[model samples]
Target chain A: MSTSTNVRLAGLHARYQFVETVRVPIAVIGTTLFPTLSLLFFIVPQSFAQDPAAATAATAQLAVFAVMSVSLFNYGVGVAEERALPWDGYTRTLPAGPSPRLVGRLLNGLAFVILGLVPLVLLAWLLTAATLPPSRLALTAAALLAAGFPLFAIGIGIGYSMSTKAALAVAQSLLLPLAFGGGLFLPPETFPGWLNSISMWLPTRAGRDLVVTATTGVDLPGPTVFVLGGWTLLAGSLAVWAYRRDEGRRFR
Target chain B: MEILARTVQATRCYGPVIALDGVSLDVPAGQLLGLLGPNGAGKTTLLQLLPGLRRPTSGTVELFGGYPRDAARRRRLGCTPQETGLPPTLRVHEVVEFVAGHFADPVPTPELLEQFGLTGLERRQSGGLSGGQKRRLTVAVAFVGRPDLVLLDEPTTGLDVEARHALWDAVRRYHQGGGTVVLTSHYLEEVEALAERVVVIDQGRVRADGTLADVRSLVPARRVRLRAPDLPELAGVERSNRDGDRHELWTADSDALVRQLVTMGIPFRDLEVATASLEEAFLALTAPGTQTVALIDGELAR
Candidate 1:
C-alpha cells in the first residue's frame, strides 16, 4: 500500500533469502573457500609476499576476484535454480511487483560477497607483508564492492536466460577466463603485450585496476572508471532484457 | 450477485497447443465454484488467466471489473498453481510469515497455520514435511492475505483422503465466511462435495456450466445393472459395459426398459435401476460428438 510498507517487505524478503542460503552453509563455504585457499597456499609463502606493494596489490586483486565469483555464482546459478521452482512463480505473481524480489536478491548477493572477502582479507593480513592504511582499506572495500555491480548484472542475466545446469557451466566457464584475462590471477605488469592491452577494457580488469588503485596508489594508465561504468551499463541492460525475455516466455 | 471475475471468449495458446479455447465464464462474489475437468482440460490455464499469472492470447479476462493485470486489483486476489515447491531450508513459520508480509493486512501466521492443521509442523522445514502437509501449507498460504477471491488449482491433488476432507472442511469454512473460491479438480466427488456451482470443462471448452443439479439434468440417462444366464440384444440400450457377470447399461429411459423386460418376461435377476452419479453425467457430457454446445446453450437459457 504505502512506500514504507513496500520497503519493509523488501527487507523481509532479503532476510528470508539470506537465511535460506545461510542454512545450507555449504554454498557459502564453497564460494568463499577457493579464494582464501589460493591466497594462503599460492601467494603467502612466495617471494611476492616479501614485497609489500606487490603483496598488497595481489591481495586486493584476489579479494576482487572473490567478490566476482560470489556474485556470479550466487546470482546466476541461484536465480536459475529459483526460476525452476513454483515458489518463484507464486512470488512473481504477487502484487508487490519485481522490485522487492530483485532488490532482495541483490542484497543476498552482497551478503555473500562480504562473507567471501572475510577469509581472504584475514589471511592477507596475518600471513603476508601486505599492508593498507585504514583509509585505503575502507576505500578498497568500497571500490571492490563497486566492481561487483557488473558481475552481479552478468550473473542475473545468465540466471534469467539459462537453466540451472547451463547457468552453472556458463558461470564457471566465464569466471576463470575473466579472472585470468583481466589480470586477476597474475599482475597486469607481467601480462604479455596483447593480453595486457586487452585486459584494460575488460570489466574484471577495470574492477581489479580500480581496487588496486584504491589500495596501492597506482595511477591507472587507461580509463578504468569509464571501462567499469560502461560494463555496468551494458550488463544492467542485458539483465533487464533477460528478465523480460523470461517473463514473456513463461508468463505471457 | 456481484461478478468478481469474468472471461469473455478467452483463448490461450502455448506454442501450437491450445489450452483455453474461447471459454466464457463468470465467477460471482461469495460463490464457491468448482471447475471439474480431466487433466489438461484447460482448468489450470483458465485459473491462471483470472489471477494475471498468464495473459490470454485473445479476448479479455477481468477481475473486480478491471483488467486482471492491474496490480492494485490483483492485491485482493490469491492463487495456488498446480505445483508449488517451498524453499526447503526455511522453517514453515518463516515461509508463512514471509508471504504474509506482502499483504496490507494479513492473518496471523500461527492462526492461519492452525486453520490448515499445520500448527504442529510450524518449526519443521517445509522440505522435511510430508507431501500432504506441504499441500496443506500451500493452500493455507493462499488465504494468508485474506483475499476476497482465491483460486486453488488442484489443492488436494496429492493429499490422502483424510487430508482432502480436512482441506474441504477448511474451504467450506472459508466459503461460509463469505470468501469467493474457484477451485479446479479432476475428482467429480470433490466438486459435488464443495461446490454450490459447477462448471464442467473438456477439450478447452466449457461443456456445462450451472448448478450441480442443473448440470446433472443435462444428462438424463439412468444406469441399469442386471445379470442373466444369456442376454439378447436390447434396442433402447445406448451403451453397455460388462463388469464380471453383470452388465451395466446406460439408457435414456430406464422405466421403458424395465417395463419392456417385464412384458417380455426375460429371465433376469438382481435388477437395479439408479440415477447416474456426477461422474457418469460428466462422462456423458464430455463424450465425443455428444452435442455439448447445444446442452450448454439449453442450460444457459433456463
Candidate 2:
C-alpha cells in the first residue's frame, strides 16, 4: 500500500506549477506592458512641475506603480486567485501541515516586492537627477522595501479578507489615491498645510522622499524613516491580525 | 469495512447557521458504515470535522487515536467530500502526483490511472473529463494514501449503475484487505450493497445507528404479497392497483402472517412473505416529528 506523510510537498509543487503557468502573463502584464504604462503617470504632471517645489510632488506621483505592484496586485490579486482555485481545496484536504502550506506559497508576496519596484527604479534611473548614486542605490532599494511595507501588508491583507471581486474593487479604489497622496506623482511640498503634514507620514510620500533624499544627499532622514516605519508596522499588524482571525473557510 | 472514526460532542457553525450540533459516533474497522441523511442534515459538516478540514466550534474530533488536525492522524485517513471539485487545468497525472508527493509512499501515478480505468487518459485535463470520469478520479485521489480509514461522502454520486457496482466491488475488496470505509450518500442501494452498518441523521442529530437488519427491525420487515380470490380489503394491507388479485402488507413477522393466511385458508390464489430491507426502516427512522435518540449505545439498539 502507498504510505502517507504530512509534509507539505503538494504546496511546493503547486507554487512552482503556478509560477510556470503564469510566467507568460506575468511577463506580458508585469514586465513588457508595465514599463510602457509606467510612463503614463507623467501625462498630467508636467504642469505640476511648473512650480519648482512641485517637482518633488511630481516625483512622488510618478512612483505610484512601484508601490501598487508591491502592495495591491502582488498580495491581493495573486493570493485571491490562488485561494479561488480548487487546488486550494486540495491543500485543505492534504496530509500537509499548515505551516508547510503557508511557507512556500507566501513567497509570491515577496515577489510582489520586486514587481512593485521595477517601474520606480526604472523611473528613477531614467532621470539622471533622480538617480541614487551607485554608493546609495542599495540603501534606496532598502528604503523602497520599507516604504512598500504598509502597502504590501495592506495588499496581502485585503487579498485574504475580500473575495476576488472585492479585492479588485479595493485595489482600484486605493491604488491612485495612495500614489497621489504619498506624492509619488506630485510634490508634497505644494500641498496645503494640513495635507502636507498628512503626506509626511503617508507610505508613498515617505518612499519618494527617502529615495529622493538618498539620491540627492538631503537631510530628510528623521521624518522619512518614521513615516515609512509607522505605516509598515501598522499595516503589517493589521495584515497578520486579519490572517489569524480568518474563519479558515475556503471560499470567496 | 468498519472504522473507529469517532467524534465527541462536535459542533460547528458557519457564522451562526449551526452546521453540526452535539454529535458523537463510533464506526468500527473493516466494515462500511453509511451516514444516511437528507441535505442540511449535518452529514458534510460531520465528515469535514473528522477530516480536520474544519475545526469543531465547541468540541474535539478524533480520527483514529489523535486529534483530527494532527498530521499523523490525517496521514492514515482518506476523505472524499460531496463537491468533488478537481483543478480544471491540471492533467490527471499531475493531480495524482501532486497528492502523492504529500504521502510518504503514494500509489504509482500509472497504477492509479490504470486502477481507476483512466489508463490512457492520464494526460487529459480534469476539466475536460466527463462526470463519471471525475468521480473516478476523485476516488483514485482519496485512495492515494492507501489509508486504513476512508471517509466517502456521496461516493457513487455521478456513476451509472454499472460504474457504481464496479466501484462497490473495489470497496468490498478494500474491506477484504482489512481497510475501513465510512460513507454518506442518498443512494440507498449503494449503501445497502456496501455498508455493513448505517447511521441515519436528521436535522443535525443521528436518528438511527445499527446494522441493516436492526434498522429494518425498527419498522416491520415483512411485506405480504398474495393472490386474493376477490378484492377483499384487509385491514393493514396496502392496496395493489395492478391487474392481479394480489395484495401487499408491510409487517415484521413474515412466518406468523403467512401461517395465519394459510390456517385461515383465506380465499387466496397464492401467498408468500418477506422482510423489509434497510430502506423502509431508514425512512421511518428519519421521518419528521418522530423523536429518535442520538449517541446510541450498542446494547440499546437491540
Q: How displaced is residue A162 in candidate 2, in Å? A: 2.6
- Docking level of model 2: acceptable
What digit string (tens of lDDT, one per residue) describes model 2 on residues B1-302?
A: 34467887877778878877888888677877888888899998888788777788887777877776667677877766233467666788877777777677787899877777878988887778999888888887888888888888787787998888777887888889988888888888778888888788878877878787666566655777777766444444432334466676676566666666667768776666666677766766776876756325333441
Task: Indicate the residue-level lDDT of A138 in model 1.
Answer: 78
RMSD of each: 2.6, 5.5
Per-model i-RMS:
1.9, 4.8
What number of backbone clashes does candidate 2 have, counting pairs of residues 3 or more apart or in separate chains?
Answer: 32
Q: Model 1's chain B TM-score? A: 0.89
Maximum-TM-score candidate? 1
Q: Which model scores highest in DockQ? A: 1
Displacement of the residue B166 alpha carbon in candidate 1, Å: 1.3
Model 1 chain A poorest ten-residue lDDT run: A1-10
DockQ of each model vs. true complex? 0.64, 0.28
Candidate 1: segments with Cα more than 4 A from true spot: B81-84, B228-247, B250-260, B294-302
